[model samples]
Target: MKKTKLALALTSAVFASSAMATNGTNMIGIGAQSMAMGGTGVAAYFGAENLLANPALIGKSQGTELIFGGTIFAPDVSSEHNLGEPASPGEPVGKDSSDANLFVVPSAAFNSRINENMVYGIGMFGTSGMGVDYQDNGQMFRAQSALQILRFAPALAFHNETAGIGFSPIIQYGALDIHYDGSETQYGTFGLEDAGHGMAQGLGFGYSIGGYYDAAPGLTLAASYTSGIEMEYKGQLSSASQPFAEFGMIPEAFDDKLEQPAEMKVGASFDMGSLTFTADARKIMWSEAKGYKDFGWQDQDVFSIGAKYSTKSYWLAAGYNTGDNPIKEQDGTTTEGATINFFNNTFFPATTESHITVGGGMAISKKATIEGAFVYAPEVKTRVGVSGIGDDYPIAGAASGDYSETKHSQTAATMMIRYNFD
Candidate 1:
């Protein structure tokens, strides 16, 4: 039995390193389920370890079953400029705003009980995804026209309990890409077009250890902590206008490495007759991370919580979370007035908090379970210097206009199908 379990763990870790690497729900949790539950799996089933939320939550269940699912994600944004000075909402010269775009994602998981007390499973889920299109139209219409940012992860887990405790170690894989166009500040608005240009890309890796403890009958508490990974990316750099010019190629000196923030995670679940209540808290150590390499960046803290209720026929859950921004203006960047700049923030953002989620599960048959979930996460708003598109800026061109922040939001849904094989 020990040999078989050991093999499973090694195989799971190996698979994880080759596939995905993602972090935080929104730099707060991992995904919708954890996000719906205040950011961690406190009351979740110890089934497949596919989702990266909590590696310890995946375990074997009686019956041979297959679970397939998907999520549709939508993001929105809004920005207000020249604040403190007071500006009209209809006035276009001072502030501008737009939505990122809608995203459709899919997920799958398979779980099986090795015996009455052992379980193992694997799943494929989205760790993170980002997109923007502020420049689809003409560049002159806005101060800055651009698009950029991406970070994603996929993982696996294991669980077993005869009465003592359950343990799981998760391995993660990650990759991020960023791009953006340069914008300049004019009379009262940020200027747009290929004024400046640049691109940055990176690969990251990391993992965590987690476990479950049964303090009472049908009641257990789970805890897991993760250390972030760092990735230094290199790409082409140039002004929006002079792409093939002197600075067309990204300079080695300007190339940079950024670290994922470390976080402490805690969660628990209580079974009450036919109901289950869950809660979770997490503290992301953004402070441990470094600012952007050439442009400069700083990390921020994140917190979250969630609850769930279950019955013989079905189950429902919900949660919320908040965090600090990682974007900061550096003292001396290449651009004169612009102290420092950021090209891509998929690995970093100024507004990294505030999310709400809801989801449920239903029995499809005596041996199968079907589930679905939805989340509403509005974009965050912040200020930097003079000109700012929303936070979802493009991948290239670090210094846009100066002194301004951006806003962003997210809305998404997920569905899962599972079969139990005893």
Candidate 2:
């Protein structure tokens, strides 16, 4: 179709590569209520989203419950190129912005109590993913990319009077595409048209385990663990796309191995009268994962706290969440800096660090409820210093400086509808 439409599709592909449905690259929370509460459902109860959080929560749910909803995500991304101070009067500074800004993600879950001690359920949701599509500015850094992950999980939970445990085998589907201009790269060995541009898709499997225990009156302790998934994408690049293609070996097929990271979370919730408070701590092993580590990512720790006030007809919640930036700063082109490998900083910057969330739920009827939440993460910026090319090197369209930087931010809103079967 149109150029922007094609770019949008490819951008979505890039979004799938990261597990960033909510938190940093992993969704901070699954359902609207959980998101509103700063993704604090780990130790608390959050209806259907528990399948993605703690499978044991399915057994804690009341009668048959179903939730369906989606999020409207919007992100702002920009980049700057720092080419030392102006040697001449009124020299221009380089800057650019991403063209793709809005994306829609969907989610759903169902839980049914088979007996007093058992619960069975199914959930289909988007785990995490994000990307940027920078329009052509200078020839060196123009790139477009994105990735998204969809998960299907069938879960089971068992519970008694004091504790409950649950398990779910996860099936995930992901796709990715990247486009960058390679000809102008200062590091010529980092070929683009050859190894950088193209599309790929893959399937993988993983599992999650979790449980919860009632500690005292109106208080509970909970924990969950998710395993990593390994996937290999079979990709293709066209002969007309970039570098001249050699008709060898399937002509267009290539493979990329991507691994989604594992995570552990612990949390607690206490309720007194009409107010409930929750706190959670989570650790994501990004550096141990395949794709992220390959791109120079570091492990991250996330912390969140939230409070909810409940009345007979409505409930309101607010919270804050923060984590470390996954995108490591680009060191100078020293031997140490050269060891830190990163690709497409302008097109795939994952830099947002903290969020403020607020949300509320309205009861429509005895069987149905609707919830909505808003999340905001302010701007984050980083400067990257590249090796190779230096100043004044563009000898008749040859090469220039390798210094660059980027600034990025995000805003998202989500809505969900829940139905109760009695």
Candidate 3:
């Protein structure tokens, strides 16, 4: 029972804040400085936080340092649908906001100079996930789902006056839970009950490699690549529960694995006296991923730009980031296509595309610094199920005009404290 409760807590946290993430299911940045700077850290140095962005930057650390932080993420999400007719009379066709709205993500890192030319560090961060809860409202088939991912990375870097390179071996833990009440829909009376089979958990391994070069005085360029991690959650996708078994919606032979997509990034930072500018561009190969590709997710290209001004005691930063939504509406010409489209929008609405960020840092003492950042993402709307439903489909009142629309927006605040040791 304790394990069940823990699973439920993890599941609820991920689902509640899923849409608050900016780039697909990923947070725009890891540390308060990075978050404030529009997630552009590839070519920039921001103390120990560099462990997650470009480990090579650790070589630039002044001395042993420890940084800890958390983000309060809040998402505003709502769904409205008129899918032909309700299974029971008097069900309303209107929009309703999800009660799940807030979550906190934590991060910490420790880095030290091993020698004159080498550095080592370890970092733990909440990396990626997606989910939503519409259970109480029941507007979109009472769907609820959550995916949580965490990464533990240990890194090593070697550098000289002009260039540096680093590598980190990554261990990732993931949890997934999917539930819905299809019984009240025009579709067949079937759904994956909440906690019916418990939450599915797995671990996977990957690696990140990066290098940076000081092209000129006050100018740096860097690039990095992260490998994909494949994980399988036993019994989660292929459970043989009663309604799921009877409906035969998911074939028993289906694979239960979902692979995190690989990422490639390149960035540059220019420092001019008291001001600095940074820019980055990255690509996420979702089309090549396993579960995501099967569900019609496309590749995403993300771009970020930021600027910072610094004085002896304080620094202020601002940034902008944009990415195209990876999940696109499918041409539901076949029953199978329509079903896949319905599931994609209803359960995994990773549709946020833009973010604006601002932040500042203050030196409270000779060895202690505090940083804070705020991020906002404008609302984005998407609709699905408009394509004609074939006659062969088993739903009772589903019509060609039946469709569901979702609106998602987000706001988050991050705070971090950094302590330096002589």
Candidate maximizing TM-score: 3
Ranking by TM-score: 3, 2, 1
In terms of TM-score, how similar is model 1 to the real structure? Answer: 0.67
Model 3 poorest 10 in a row by lDDT: 1-10
Top of the candidates by lDDT: 3
- The per-model lDDT (C-alpha) reads 0.45, 0.70, 0.76
Give candidate 3 regions above 4 Å deviation.
1-19, 86-94, 190-195, 240-253, 395-400
Question: Mind giving the per-residue lDDT tens digits that candidate 2 earns over 294-401?
Answer: 455678899999999988778999999998877565454542342231233544566677889999998999889999999888887766665432422222343334
* Between candidates 2 and 3, the TM-score winner: 3
Query: Model 2 residue 361 lDDT?
Result: 94
Q: What would the TM-scores of all predictions be?
A: 0.67, 0.84, 0.90
Who is ahead in lDDT, 1 or 2? Answer: 2
Model 2 lDDT on a 0 to 1 scale: 0.70
1-422 in candidate 3: lDDT tens per residue? Answer: 01111112112222333545568888888898899999999999998898878888898887899999988888888766555654456453545677667878889999999999999999999878666777775445566667788899999999999999999999999998766554544543434334235688999999999999999999999999988899887765544233433454333333567788899999999999999999999998988876666556789999999999998889999999999988777666555555445555545667788999999999999999999999999988888764545345444555543676778888999999999996
Which residue pairs show collisions in model 3? none
